[model samples]
Target: MPTDPQAYRPATALLTLGEGFFDPVAPADFPETHLRFRNQRAAAEIGVDPLTDEEWIRHFGRFDPLPDTLPAPLALRYHGHQFRSYNPDIGDGRGFTFAQLHDASGRLMDLGTKGSGTTPYSRSGDGRLTLKGGVREILATEMLQALNVPTSRTLSLIESGEALARGDEPSPTRSAVLVRLSHSHVRIGTFQRLAYEQDESAMRRLIGYVLHNLYGEDGDDPIRLLDLVVARTATLAARYMAAGFVHGVLNSDNINVTGESFDYGPWRFAPTWDPAFTAAYFDYQGLYAFGRQPEAIHWDVMQLAVSLRLLVDTEPLIAALDRFAPLYGEAVTQAILWRLGVMPGDPDADRSLVQAVERALRDTEVPIDRFFFDAFGGRLPDAYGTGWTEVRDALAGRTARGERVHPYWSGAPCSMLIDEVEAIWARIDQDDDWSALDAKVAAIRAMGDALA
Candidate 1:
């Protein structure tokens, strides 16, 4: 806590990057251009005051020579498992945490930037983000919040007037910087890096830091830290399942050790419930698929436990790892039940509904957004149009599948709200009226609130 809660203050000191905390190479790639947004509005929501333009420049901005900033970045050097493979080297490739601030909400928030420039960890690529990626992240963060998912919020988006090149698209493309708000950017791999180096002292220090910064000092026992993190990971995994989200990449490097959801790369929501639904085109094996998320998280936690063993009792660590499965299962079941908005009527009906969802994913290939929208919301009338009719009819047909019909009929009242909204969307599309569309969306959103 600060003496003056309302006043914004500069960081007490600068944290410069070093070999001990990061790799020893420049970023493999750099953003050709850069842009910035205040995101002060978002900061305020979490109880942090925005810096004035001068303040931002004085504290965070490095607007001087091209690829500015002295690269005095530090406070990184965490390790994580990339796609289940132990990767000993990884940390702050293009960005670094400048400071950690205590928000008005009493939450400690990390102020970090992406596309700021390159560092030793840059590897063989430019450390920059495309404008499109920035925009998509903004939309994803906003939608995730609306849907009540635990995620890093986009604090700001800025464009640097530079050109860059990349394999996925083109070179010298426009660049943008994104500020991500999260509990901590620390990942499971952070510990892995130290463990791999045989640096037991550093690993112990890292565990101490995590316990103090994330879990708090009162409960700072290293054994308890392992237990808490494992349980938290399980809970988060369940939350993802409940919300129909698929984090395309669940590698150790991307799994935040703080237990807050971070590293939003090619993430998506389940259209139906296909176990293999994945957002990343490159995730060929579906290692991070929709259904495998829980398992991936479990694996990540196990990695964390193994790393933490340098400082804690091995038995307690193993015991913590063992708790993940049952906890995750209980959480998933509860989340699904709540999502269906059911009363405690028939146990078979709940079972049938889940089975029906699983079958729907296998039966057809449809847009994930449309599938959830139609099923959770409602079906559009035929007058709605091509996509609307398709979704409406699909839900109607899905309801007739064996024992599933019992819950389908019971859920109609809950589902009708979605159906009516789809009808309104169809009306708007037919009319090509923006104002009408906005008004209808507002009404539908209000209805969702009432239903919620």
Candidate 2:
């Protein structure tokens, strides 16, 4: 039976864990609440598709409590490693868990806000998000979701009518508030904070809450939890590679226990298969570059294991961490095959195909997305060298997944490279034109459907 799109089921699951996990905070009062973007597809899943634009602003922009759900927004607290440097003074500085609900599939969903307001963790900075920053996040999430990456969906964007100064972008930029729909907001840093405080009881309680509410498990066994997180994180890293995405920041706090990618900032798609391709300008050392992402993610998972050490012994945790490399390798093979729209082969054959693809990508320096686009369903044009020929041979005997009937597959691949991102933002910034953004999203979704 199809679930009713109008029947919203709200949950207070996070509240059950107690107030120590979060601090209640108020949303910023924006002078103007002009709705910039609304994710109807995401809203339909959560049973909020029927909301009018005015009503949407009231809830998302003005921060009205959802019916029978959270009475106040929660500014979640945690600590994290920023660029491998431990920072205890970080948390939900500008965002909060606004509300919780279940999607059509009955999975717990969080309606979280970014740039909502200032919290105790604001740390002398204004609690706000740039309008351009919000726009970038929208593009990043949409493209990632289209690429089948496990990620947060941008639910709403509303211009807040504020001028803000930023060091990265042009000063006096526009401001906006964004709402994201995600599976879980409980991060690795959430556990790290408890361990840092040496509060074993709180750590155990949080573990129990996470396993039950987010993962649908009931036990608080640290080893079990670490194993699960490790596997999911590995899959996530593999997907990022398949999509040629540089997350720019793979800090422990940005990594949630659910392993769903969220909090997009300084994200970029690799133009070519360059290991040192970095997305963030401030990442001088290339610590979180495209090639190092797997390592960074593994390191973050290790932090989670360290945090869990407060509750369990070290040897089992080390055993769990050992699973990451093998799991990541397997996941990479699977992810690449899926992107290539081909049936799985034997492990050795599949690995050979992946390696061949990598070699072709590096040797040809072909645009990453274009290479995948050109090689769709194991079909590659003859205009390439031995590396591509190696890839073509490795793909032999594997059945393509489905017919590429969609019009999108007949054209150049839809990509979200940085220049296109800047052009999209320029349209909105200069002329308030959203036609390009809309068109790109339509194209991206069309590609997603074709790939599907």
Candidate 3:
């Protein structure tokens, strides 16, 4: 961690794209501020992990710009389709991209906020996040990262000391502001807004910016861009399935251009292999259910393809879009094998094994997360009981990488069930005792280290 804040060079890479892209906005403070969490692992990217707790709170809590950060945060402009219906007015209502810095790996990272304050897009609702909501997102990101899902990390969370009323859960809920470390905040909705405006020049400029920065274009055309994004989206979709997760909202706006998952609202890990299992309680139609996630993500990618048409032709875009199904098919098998701790030398055989595993999980109705944590890092036939004998034999005669399971796995499986998460938070809510939350975080980190 760098001691000098001056060493932190914030890059306004997206801002350089110019007008209609984003608007300068200031973070409005709350009644009070108390830093709740800081992500040291993510902070080491920009070399600020060793800052004193007071210093961390001052910068993130006060919304103070890091040295050479953006003169002011930018509330990005974008439009998106919600549940397949186009909504042209939505953008960053409660959050803004605060700063950008290249990590040790030379990958550009963004420090973005949620519940910092209101903006032009704040419609009618208060531009605030519930403290409970903040805690939930923290847990969501931590668990997803532990499970090896490509996701954003919560860098900081602060209780904003505001009592807010809401209809979704209990009223007079505590409020908070959260900061996330992500590769980029640019989304598919960014392009959709430009397309809606019929600003073809802006569309081309945005595409060029994305290709030059994130996609690493080499004399590539829009077709190549579409193909790249399609592949990434397919890979991410497969990982989500293997992780047994359902991102309740896969709206176009929520689909990151980097194809990394973020914005973890109304998300859940499946307790079983049920296709119709939905995460968001408000999702009455089962639109973004666990099993339908692949379909939803593919549909979102289609929106990105449609936006690209403002700069390119129809034929190549269609061809690129066609790659989703096969790419997803191949990805799912690889993901399952990765979770099961095996190398796939034979594609046909590995696929058959995955199919058998899925059939077994469905027929036996085994708890989803427990099954993986217990079976992770290929085990021998004698290690399992008769109940798992079929699964063991099917995975027999296959090369399995060893040294995966830990001493902790021998007891109870490491799990992040909803009930457990709520119980952890309940302790904090009732007595401001954070020991449970801290213990859970430590355990999850240990699980990730063992898996690695």
Candidate 4:
């Protein structure tokens, strides 16, 4: 890991696409800075893991655009469906794509910020992020990554030394700035905004840019793009189910074009198999509930298909949209075995094993997370429950035997339960103690490393 933050000058690849996609923006000045977290693993991607905390604040907190990074931060513009309603006045209101750099594998990665400052899209809101919100997102991404979900990583989080009054969770919450590293910041809403404005030319350009830069396809064949995105989205939905995560908002703006999950806001990992479990408090209708996620995602993809109509014929796009259900089903079946640490020997047998596992867990009322932790590597506990006989028989085909799993799995599983999260924050708020938060993150990362 390089010790200096300025070692790599990112390509700022998105800037090459041109004027209509984004607007230049700067970060808000904070009263003080305390570097809270730095993802060393993520830093190794761009070779900046060795930077000192002071250097971290200088580059990430001071809002000094690195001379080698993006020339200037750009607040991307896009519109989206908010709660299934068309909202044209939405964009990067509180954050911007700070820079883009190539990872060790040569995939272009974006360094984006949240709670940076106000922009043209900040209609009536203060563009500040609560410290609690920052902590929540860090946990969300870490837990999702541990469960093998395609997601972003929190690169840096710094307390901005400002207390803010907010109506949501708590008043006078501390403020923060968060940096996340992801494959792309371009969203489905990007196309929606272009289509809504009747900018077919920009739409075509954007499509080609996404395909070429992100997908490694040279030409803008919109049909092929649709199929790729559809397949990825299907697997994405399956990943969420296997992980028991409810991604509060399935809006077009929150759905990345790359289909990797990011922009976490009231995300939660289900403690049980409750389908109607909703993550966000305001989702009264349960539209984006755990069970409705697949439906909501399919609907969002249709809107994306609608935008692609400007360039491609309707039949092919429709055909791509039709693949989601089957693909999602197949992916979930395979993911079940993967999570169980089995090699998935036979397709039909794998499906049967998954069905058996689900039936057993649902019948016994065993927590989904606990089942996975206990039965990891195909080891069933000696003590049998109501469904263990069948579960044991089904797992017999699991040829999983001795394998190297981290010691963390042998102990109590680290969970992202909301009560536990609130307790961690309570210590910080009441006694200014940060050890609990630090230990939680460390345990989460250890689990992720074991999964890898």
Candidate closest to the true structure, highest lDDT: 2
TM for every model, in the order presented, reads 0.72, 0.98, 0.95, 0.96
lDDT per residue for candidate 1 within 69-122, as digits (tens), equals 234344367667776666555678777765565555555566666776777666
Residue by residue across 187-207, what tens digits does model 2's lDDT show?
999999999999998998988
**Runs in model 2 lying further than 4 Å from the true structure:** 1-7
- Over 4 Å off in model 3, which ranges? 1-9, 218-220, 380-390
lDDT for model 3 comes to 0.83
Residue 199, model 1: Cα distance from true site in angstroms: 2.5
Q: How close is candidate 3 to the true structure, as a TM-score?
A: 0.95
Window of ten residues with lowest summed lDDT in model 1: 9-18
Best by TM-score: 2
lDDT of all predictions = 0.60, 0.91, 0.83, 0.85
Residue 103 deviation, candidate 4, in Å?
0.6
Model 3 lDDT tens row, 63-131: 777766676788999999999999999999999988888777767788999898999898996889988
lDDT of 1: 0.60
Please provide, for model 4 over 104-123, each residue's C-alpha lDDT reduced to its tens digit, 9 standing for 90 to 100: 78788898999988988898
Q: What are the C-alpha RMSDs, in order, of all predicted structures?
A: 8.8, 1.8, 2.0, 1.9
